[model samples]
Target: MSWVILIVSGVLEAVWATALGKSEGFTKLWPTVILGVALVASMGGLALAMRDISTGTAYAVWVGIGAALTVAYAMIFGGEPTSIVKVLLLLGLVGCVVGLKLVDTSH
Candidate 1:
């Protein structure tokens, strides 16, 4: 389904994002490779999903998922500081994403 592809793409976006940060300006071979692979897959999936999903909603959802997961991963494993405010903000972003999905009437 398009939604499934879009969600996977969003997750790949996060993977590429995290890999980029770990790549050290492309100096790290493995991370850089991972970034490239994930980036391509993410973009490809996005294009595929766009056939069914509105561009604006799809893009916003992809970005929201990628951003939330990236920051959450950093906070959990990359030594980034975590706070209640940040958690709430992430939850709000997730809620907004879900709301968009629920309100989609283009069936």
Candidate 2:
């Protein structure tokens, strides 16, 4: 389903973003290669999802999910700060994604 593809694409976006961070300015060869492959795969999945979903809505959801997941990953593994404000912001991002899905499905 298009929604499934979109979700997968969003997750891949998280993976690629983490890979990019690990690539150390692209000086690390393996992580950089992983980042490139994940980026391509995520984009391809997004293109497929766009065949059925509205571009504006799908893009917003995709980016929202990607950003939230990336931030969570960074906080958990990359020693990034996990303040209360950041947690609330991530929750708000999740709420936006849920709201978009609800509106999209109700149509």
How much lDDT does candidate 1 score? Answer: 0.94
TM-scores of the candidates in the order shown: 0.98, 0.94
Off by over 4 Å in 2: 105-107
RMSD of each: 0.6, 1.4
Please provide, for model 1 over 1-107, each residue's C-alpha lDDT reduced to its tens digit, 9 standing for 90 to 100: 88899899999999999999999999999999999999999999999988999999999999999999999999999998999999999999999999888887654
Report the lDDT of model 1 for residue 97.
Answer: 90
| Candidate number of the best TM-score | 1
Task: For candidate 1, list the clashing residue pairs, or say none.
Answer: none
In order, the Cα lDDT scores of the candidates are 0.94, 0.92
